[model samples]
Target chain A: MPSTTATTRRALLRTGAAGALAATVPASPRAQGPARGEPLRVGVMTDLSGPFAGAGSQPLFWGAEVAIELFNERGGVDGRPVQAVTADSQSKADVAINEAERLLGQEGLEVVTGIYSSAHAVPLSGRFEQARKIMWITSAISTAVLKDRNLRYVFRPTVHSDQYGEASVSFIHEHAQSKLGTPPERVRLAAIYEDGPYGTGVAAAIEANAKARNMPLVLKEGYSASAPDLSTLVTKLRRERPDVILHTGYNPDITLFLRQAKAGGLRFKALIGHGAGYAQIDRLTEAFGNDVNYVYNVDPVGTQMLDWSKLGPGVGDLAKVFVERYQAKHRVRDLPAHASMGFNNTWIFLEHVLKPAVRKTGGMSAEALREAALAVDIPVGGTIQGYGVKFAAPGTPMSGQNERAFPVVMQFENARGRVVWPTAIASAPPVLPLPPSSPYAARS
Target chain B: MDPFLLEALVNGVLLGGVFALPVLGLNLVFGVVDVIWLCYAELVMVGMYAVWFLYTQAGWPLPLAFAACLPFVAALGVLLHVLVVRPLLRAPPINQVLATGGVLFVLQGVATLVFSTDFRSLGVEMPPMEVGEVFVSGTKLAAFLAALAGAAALWAFLKFTYVGTAIRAIARDREVMPLMGVDPRRIYLITSAVGGTLAGFAACLLVVQLDVHPFVGLSFGPITFMICVMGGLGNMLGGFLAAFLMGLIVSVGGFWWNTEMSYVVAFVFFIAVMFLRPQGLFAR
Candidate 1:
């Protein structure tokens, strides 16, 4: 009986192996080409019901959905329809890891994207790498994820924290000299960042860049993200009297800082913010109104004030269509930068990587998809934000970082955010020393 | 003393005034009810959302919206007490804390669903009033004065009013209050309503200066709890003084060091006080 059971097991193994080969055989057209209308599944894991839900998750999800809609409207990826399977991570890293596993293993998705918090993204990046799946990070800008991890499957197409800090410093240097008549050395800079990964990374970058440029960093401070008050910090800032203040924090802290600063009579020649709360234009405007005006923020360009010519032909029209459809779908007048970048990067991924991979390999397998992403080299002006898509080589400092991605400096002018740096695409020049009529003008 | 330090100290005291209103109710609720009311800060949060909806969304006048918040939140407090707290009154103290914790999550979840977690602010524009070399914000000063006035009015009521005296008697000994012809349940209900009203009042004062989001309460919730603990649970005057003390320490420490260090110093002070005086600074 034992010998008969062994013989049956061997036969079963041989039969299963043969069946697997038969399924993959070139003779089966259904196996080679995606079934006529079968939708390509891409997972979008984000914090839909957590602390970050309003911050970026909702918009990030909408952004990716808009991209998929655009792709499907244009006869998706080699005529194989693309769809997004969304999972709410609830802004928790462990939940994100579980969602990634379920999406990749149970849902059988080849590519996953959309994580708002670095805490969620970093862990998912490792899981994706281990699983040999592709993860396109849209919003998490922490540098630590790509710093030492040489994960080939993980790719970030958006600007990172370091770039934001560099852009902020550069914007102040250029604008201070040109607008405020203060040179780099003569400028007094202070940095106040939330004591978190995102804030610390950006602050470190700002410090490094300031030192490189010989700028005097008078004060650098860190605070908790959910601090109830910032009056004391504002008092310290007032005493320091820095010419340029670079701040990085989330929504609540940012709102508190500005309010407390107003109360403390803190003003500067150039008040530059590095993304996060400052990039939330509508929220900032709603909270501060004219007070937010004249403040400069360095971040990814939102759907507004885009130079169409900078992006490749036909991409500009697509962006407009995206904005219109997004507004109609979400019923929001303004499309945030998180949503815009999410839409653009996902569209780029679909166009330059997924579709091509499916067409070339005759199937959407994980290895084939990663190879396509690695070979992706969209020239500058190819995407909606005029950013080129090219993942850096593995094992390098820029490991998964997008080399062509750079932060754009935008100044809030007349209750609108206008690009004010990099010369070529600036909508308006930076406003320096804030006019006396401005609410933020120095009292003295 | 340096003018900068003086201004910081003044601002700290003003902040303490704002801080006292919210924590006073928590202290009151805990003192009398013998329940933690963990969702106390969330009640303040709900009041803030009500003000935002009324003033910003519905175009109601700021004063009218603020006034409306009191009744709305007071009703909510009564509902919470009847539905959630009353049943747990017979349960263990831990059960009451756990029940209120559940209420906290539910309130936050409901708030997130309704408000969409976006930061909403009234954007009340008021110019700064220059006091010599120090600039005081009009909104902060108004909030401070309102909070102080609210506290004083409540104190007066507790001192003079018949209902207020009964409530205080209940706080002193719930068992004895029943023997004194005062119904404990009725007094508890009234105390809950009063606590909710105070939270609403604090919310109105806060909304003028801060943005309102779903988790806005969480930002100050822990600190307010700490203030309650430091002041001695159930000791109103002690909590009041503790609030101001914590505010001044945070302000001065933050000025001398950084904001993070300031909080560190506060926690250190809290631990030292807890070790030396386990019942808290003002525990009777």
Candidate 2:
């Protein structure tokens, strides 16, 4: 009787263990379906309540949401609905890492994207790599994320920091020589940047590119990002008297610099900015009024500036639809440049890579998605932003860099920013020497 | 002197004048209360936002907005003293510091929640005044003059008024003042209000020049505190002199090297002064 009771007890324990194992196992994609098919989960980690909440992350989130909505409306990724699971990083690096881990480990998402500050992006990208998940960095432009670190699963779809440097120098050299009658050799350049990865990377790139092109880079200086006063810097710039000043800074610094420069009467032949603070047209205009006029900003092509007709067929329609829907949803007249880039990158991944990956592997896995992404080969004039999507392979010069990604030089004329470089898509000619009203304009 | 260096020096003096306005109040409070108000800068930030709302958003005259900010901020200061500081009077210095730090965080968080971290500027455009080859910003010059006038008024009040004398007496000996029939609590409340009033005036001067944001106080706060410490805690005149000295060091240093080096030079000077004269440049 005792032997029989022990055997029954062992049998009951075995049965309970089997049941637990079955319960712990995730349901197959088919079983988890809502009538049609199970949705593909994509995690979006963004700064919703921190420093960059308004300027960087909020717009990015809205942009991605709009893109996902448009994609689902058009039958998302081979009839399977695309679901976005979002978590706020609170503009802190540790918090960003936690959110990324939660989305990937707990929520079981295979793909993740979105980070505003480079400070947050660097660590979060590493976490994504460790998890072996595909991280499509949409907005953060720090070069350290890809170049300084050995990241395999990480990919950036937007223009990088160094690209801004190269573009600013190249545009000034070409445009100034052509429009302002300044000799290429006579174009003395000064670079003032906020002391951070974003500013330093751009400054270094500007120096290298200018050296390569044999252009004279006269002075380069770095200042604290949150310095209360930049009057001394402006005074120094005035004394040095460079023909063109290339600056890299964020909102407050840029506002302070421009205002102080104006107050000090520090004028240059042309003033150029690398995205960041310059892209916020509304804020810039509000702060400085006509002072922001004619300042050339090198940034990714904004949706408003993109002439879709010049791009391939249907690209124009896509651009129109995006702008219309974004306007309708956000109740804003213009879609932010970061938002457009986010939308475009996400759309490209879903269309060119995600759907194809699902068809090839018959399921959504990190490896399959990455393989599909690597196989993508979209040519120029194919994307809604008038640029193509073709990411360079890992362990290369342009490693994980979008080879076709380039910035357009937009000149702020009458408080309106219009594309003015690379002539083909430019709405207006480059205003070399700026307007007479500009602080950097050539004095009589 | 080279014209550029001369200009930098002049600019530094003007900037120093602006810096003194905020530091004076902080110095006064620290001198009397024997407790550091870590949230002093955030008080100025609140004043700035108030000015922006009243002057820019509500379409009130700039002078009226400035007037409104003073009382509003002074009230806020009294409220903070009553709620946060009063209970911690008997606590250790570290406890008081930690509590004030909590107040700082709370104020910053509230500002962020209400204002949404977006930068707002008054953009009070006043044409600049040119002196020789140097261009003096009209806003900066006005702010400087206002700071000087405000400093003179404060000096007069502290020197001549009975209440001011009582407050000064309390700073000398908080425990002994109450024995002499002066209510320390009432005097402390008045001191906080006066400090907040000074912050409001400083805010008006700053809002014209700098962008108003939740964290704008941080930009000027640490440096103002340094000035207070170097000025001999409660020594208003010493704080005033230190403000200009530090400002000159920053401007001249920045001119000679860079902004970072300028800060380094200022800090080094501060450290040296602290080592040599613990009571500060002016103890009396």
Candidate 3:
């Protein structure tokens, strides 16, 4: 149930075609910086026609499109407008590898960006590193993409999965005292996740962070994301009665777990979720409505939720424009966080890396972009998502990762997520224990 | 008994009940037509999309949506048999399997093209009821009962009605039935439609319990076929019993160890059952 009424997807697609048309309309020849020959070509690769299309890839490209469009409006990179050539990743790993070859090799695009799955990013980054082309990763957050891989060509300004675990556990540690009436170390915790790279990675973090702090780790298990039954898992949880549960799963499994847990009478004081499925709040809201309220999810802060005043002077206004363009065209009431990830990360490349590379070298090249990426230094609260750009330098662990990037804990209040953790960026206090109104709320 | 163990057993019975209808539908087709509609689960998937589309998109009431789902999927079953299965009836069994498999792909591809992979639900839920020390999921309980009702109705149809007798007779001896004044072609078509109605029925039950997506059939489809083969391929009663047995093993094993391990244990049991009784556990 995206607010894009079925009719609107058709309407919006036509609008999208027109928008794509408008991007290439050639800025007024007499504008400042003067028009020049041959626009800067960047390949926008994403999952446009498969499983990852709707919730993950489509908005990612839209967000990137917004950033590129705005940059072109402001007279482009020294009057060479960006002309994006898009490719479909199609939710297939093999297709992703092939598309990378096609986009970077046959198509001969130097700077390629926009990835939705870490599965795609992992292989794509490796190929780009070998081929020596600039890949400004807009939004795919697997630690494996950049972890210990000293590739200078690939760069991500988005939060990765490893940071996901730290954010949720850190929130619980800080708030367990006042809200749960329990010491952080004494809290009963359980971790459940889909037995996939993303889920396993996050679950590991949750376990490590909890154990390091001596939190009572009651149970940790992984189930296939497509399991037809979670009743047994629910029964086990009911038996243990964990005070809080850390779960990482895609939307269907999350929906299945919630439905079954309610039916099995499983109760927990609080439930924390990592991004992937949780990024689409509308889906969760459509499934549970008010029952989802007060549930905490960890992801990079949504653009609309951040206190934009602290995001430097012009960044706030740029965010307003991003939201305005994004919401009106996509017809989403509550902006999906992926769109912001698309916009901010792409903005970083356009404003920081691409422009600087072309300016410094008088034209774009992989080595110049790599140098510009390494030299990037934006302090915290610098970008639209309130995280800055600073790629983890080569030879260090997590090369090409924006070390300043971090996820925050947000709770659903009437199905709209409000930041509630990492106190400084938080707009509201963490509603720690589940309120009695929730069907799964523990009976005190 | 440990309450947890009791709950696990109850959950198994409930799980089996939902599993039974799909098994019953696929078994019905395998038994009567002698051709396994390998795309059987995809029919259920289509029916699920129909129910979801009617209820959520078309603004129909839940019951009306479900009512529409049966006939809709039944017709799809008829269409499938007419377009795909009918021509392959005279072909090799492998060719038939391949054709049906193609239908599975076509159905999945079309669903993906139309719906994408976003999981849709009926947004329906039922509370858990306490029976003494154990908790029973009311939604599952109701689905289980509905499944039993579906199984019973199918049994009654095959056992009592004139067409049912012809179907059973045809299933028993396909070559001999044609000489006995019963048109095998008509019966196959009728059975195909009936099998479809059963899929539609199962889809109704599953839509409430599980989310509907294009690849959802992958989750339960293999397991259903396993139950069918383990229950003697086309034996309705054997499939019925085997479904519960598989469900119990999955549930209790999961209770003992973990979800993935439980499935491993179920597959192992299926294999063991095959080795011990090659024709199937209850084939005789």
Candidate 4:
């Protein structure tokens, strides 16, 4: 073998010195094992045993787990298998903070992700920022978490609550006159939301955007998502007779609203829902059947519901892999948006951020990962979800948010979502106002 | 009254009717057994699950599913009383309350394990009916009527039936009932069974109006307790009337304010009632 005086980038890579960050060890020519003694460690913090389980955290974990498994199969990130240390948030902020500190201080992991609740995300971002570690959040809709805080190490690739309001209001703005035969100014709007961070954040955006556009927001009401009776709220809506109802709520509350609205003869031209419970199409179909068909929801497009052919090459196959792995483990084929979010966001962090960190920076340190994440600029259809990955530069307004990331308004048809907004990737045209068959359609 | 206020008032009555059944059941249990089943809402949760499972998963007719839910929960009530309350009948009140509270978690956990946290609705709803200027939900109206019928039947049972007489007599004086050829244990068991039956009835009504999940009990549990306490724990008619008062407060208050503020108003009213009439509005 020949000896070299200096170590070049190519030489360092050829010698498998890519694990130069920490825990470095001698490597074989084939690079069979991790260059470091241990694999790349990441923390998956989510609610596993509390109210946020099942729908929120469990799916988030499952999707991330599938991604970890697939990444390991793909010879791992930078030839080192990714290892995930999961801590159940238990859906409590105090517990989440404690677990996060343990993960950062005790476990000494450089990165932690997968927080389902916005409340946890908001508090934990401060923790991660102070620690100078990366918190690649997969899902947390509230804009307050990162709107203008300008934290250095936090990045969220998923849609935010503000965007939900933007998407919904803009969709109506685009269609108000074209389809409703009524101008945006003439449309009587109402806002009803669950009194949680998620619902409240989205509702605030709706009010702001509506006011900006000079829309007549006749009613804005907040209610408990777990309220046993929404009849009083239903009666209020009936009397107001708003042309458009912008609603944001969680699982049971959405069901309650729809059922009561149907029974209270609450008529409306349209009811636009912002994610959360609205994302669960199959469950809504189970409860309302065809009644859920025309109702629209604002959220990131489901990976399976996207036009995969238009996306980057191999995106379709990757989505297929995720679904297959998800079904094999969960024994159910119904994939909620949260699961896809867990998988896609984790996968994005791995491919767009982590790989580049190792390949370009020659290390996977927190600083290197942040640099790599900031450099990511996947345009529309670059990811499986049909949205791109491009984080807003650090220290800017909405810093670390994926400026390219946007939610679409989807109409549920036969328990399947069809993108109906943002004409470029939309699968179908927006259905303005509910059809006559809809129980909630305005009284003619 | 304004149309919206009239609708709110009508909705309050419907809401009251739904709250009535569980209140009566808890009252019956407390009156005869003199032991509060803190897990009363949990029992109703289990009954809701039973009806949902029998109707949706078991593919039974809706009526048959409801029919099965009553006895199944009644039997569960018997089991609960025998396994937990019976042993602690002579124990400290706090201990009994703690034990039942523990069972509340057990039921929620088991339900989560089996049914997951997904909301399972009955998928049953009827169109609203026009009443002059107001619109009323058919499902709520139906549930309200059923709750009233259930309460009337409970009243008739307490007044007429031999077992029912023994139950009321035990409520009046436990020591005398045992001395006068009545087995207190049997009457207590029967009271628990009746409580369970009422829970089952409430379950059927709730499943139609709300979604069934492990934590469904949390939605109505606090309000049920508040109403029972406001009505004088063991007083059935008092609890029945208190349910309507609370319901009206919730409904009309919501009309005056927001749903959340209305709840605050209702809770404040409950606290005021507690301070003013600790023995309850209809207490003897």
Clashes of 2: 1
Model 4 ranges with Cα > 4 A deviation: A1-39, A48-57, A90-110, A130-133, A327-334, A354-377, B175-181
Estimated TM-score per prediction? 0.91, 0.89, 0.90, 0.90
Tens-place lDDT per residue, model 4, B189-258, is 8888999999999999998888888878888988899999999999998999999999999999999998
List of clashing residue pairs for candidate 2: A268-A440
Report every candidate's CA lDDT.
0.82, 0.80, 0.84, 0.84
Off by over 4 Å in 1: A1-36, A91-110, A331-334, A360-365
Residue-level lDDT tens digits of model 1 in A89-181: 766677788778888988898889888877777778888889898898888898877887788888899989989888988877776677767
Model 1: DockQ vs. true structure: 0.34
DockQ of each model vs. true complex: 0.34, 0.28, 0.41, 0.34
Model 2, A406-438: lDDT tens digits are 888888865667888777777877767776766
CA lDDT, candidate 3, residue A373: 90
Q: How do all the candidates rank in terms of DockQ, highest first?
A: 3, 4, 1, 2
Candidate ranking (lDDT, best to worst):
3, 4, 1, 2
Q: Which stretches of candidate 3 lie over 4 Å from their true place?
A: A1-41, A48-58, A72-76, A79-95, A101-112, A123-125, A130-136, A358-368, B91-98, B271-281
Using TM-score, rank the candidates from best to worst: 1, 3, 4, 2
Q: Give the per-residue lDDT digits (tens) of candidate 3, residues B1-284.
A: 88988999999999999889999888888988999998898999999999999998999998999999898889998898899888988899999997888778668667876887666877888878987768899999999999999898988998899999999999899999899899998999999899999999999999998888787787789999999999999999999999999899999999999887899999998899889999999999
- In model 4, the Cα lDDT at residue A54 comes to 43
- Ten contiguous residues with the weakest lDDT in model 3 chain B: B104-113
